[model samples]
Target: MRLFSLRTLLVCTALASCLGMVGAQAATKAQPAPKPSGQKVAMLGGKFAFTLPKDYVKGPMEEIDAKARAAGVTGSLYMNKPAKRVVIITETPLPNDQKVGANDKPTLDGIIADTLQQQQSSYKDFKKLGEKKIVRKGLGMRQLDISGSVDGGRVLSTTITAAYGKRTAMVNVISLAKDAKAHAEVVKGVTGGK
Candidate 1:
């Protein structure tokens, strides 16, 4: 199954409006070093932070939102584009009526299963690459990898989802299947890898 549908994944976050245009412009013009410092950049008024690898530029939010709208998911989108890889961060508030306990494995698993079903119906060549459940910094998280052909090219996608109270965060990394390994570090940085 294709691990991620970029368009679908795009709407999963609510932080799109929080992405500053000035920062996005500067990120595009700046030449990142070969190895970035791996510093966490605070986003959404300190709700969360992400570390973009050196040499990756944040894409304009407007453009990303337009693409996401076309795909039918609406949310804030933080996209970092390196030479060969794309990492996207999305956050959206859970429905006001929804409540997820800290140890709610059944609820979390159901969410993931729904996502997988959506992918299976949306992509022609979706394949489940791998997945695992882990606790990161005391939060329950799920990591998934999947591959598929989109727009006639093979793509590999890695997605990490963490739910905290009434909010959920999802980070998606997409790369050419052959180049996915090269971007592993970038993905780890954004996903808060151990």
Candidate 2:
């Protein structure tokens, strides 16, 4: 059964934006880290703040396209276009009546399960890698390790989701699977591992 609305997991949370898949650009070189954006985005009503990495370019939330915005995704997006990598940090408001909370294990646990199911249903050749419950940035979050084929190519994805007081924040990193080391480093950096 679907624990959350289809909107919550709509089309892989903007991952379907034709990120120019992995195999096509398997030999792409790493672009030099770009200048940092000198701003911080506050989340969880100012309980947390995020700074975009110097290695990727930041695009306005509107760039995420209308479908994602309609699904209630409001946050930042970063991309290293030539490198075939994308990072989406989104803050989505949740309904007051749902089974959700920052500290609610059951809610998060169910989400991870349903999230995997949603991806399996959405992507072609979706594969489960590994996943676990983790604490990041002082919030209990669920992380998924998975891969699948999308519009442009196959990509590896590390998705971390956490809820706190009326809102849920997700850090989704999608990159060419061949750039495993680079992708893992970015995920670690953004999540602030415990």
Q: Which candidate is the best by TM-score?
A: 2
lDDT of each: 0.55, 0.67
What number of backbone clashes does candidate 2 have, counting pairs of residues 3 or more apart or in separate chains? 1
Candidate 2 residues 1-194, lDDT tens each?
32244423533655655353443445657654433353455677765555655657776656446775776657677777676677777776665545454567876776678777777877788899999777755678888989887774678988887777777777778876667877777766666652
Q: Would you give me the overall lDDT of model 1? A: 0.55
Taking the candidates one at a time, how many backbone clashes does each contain? Answer: 10, 1
Considering summed lDDT, which 10 consecutive residues are worst modelled in model 2?
1-10
Off by over 4 Å in 1: 1-48, 63-82, 101-103
Alpha-carbon runs more than 4 Å astray in model 2: 1-18, 21-27, 30-41, 61-73, 97-101
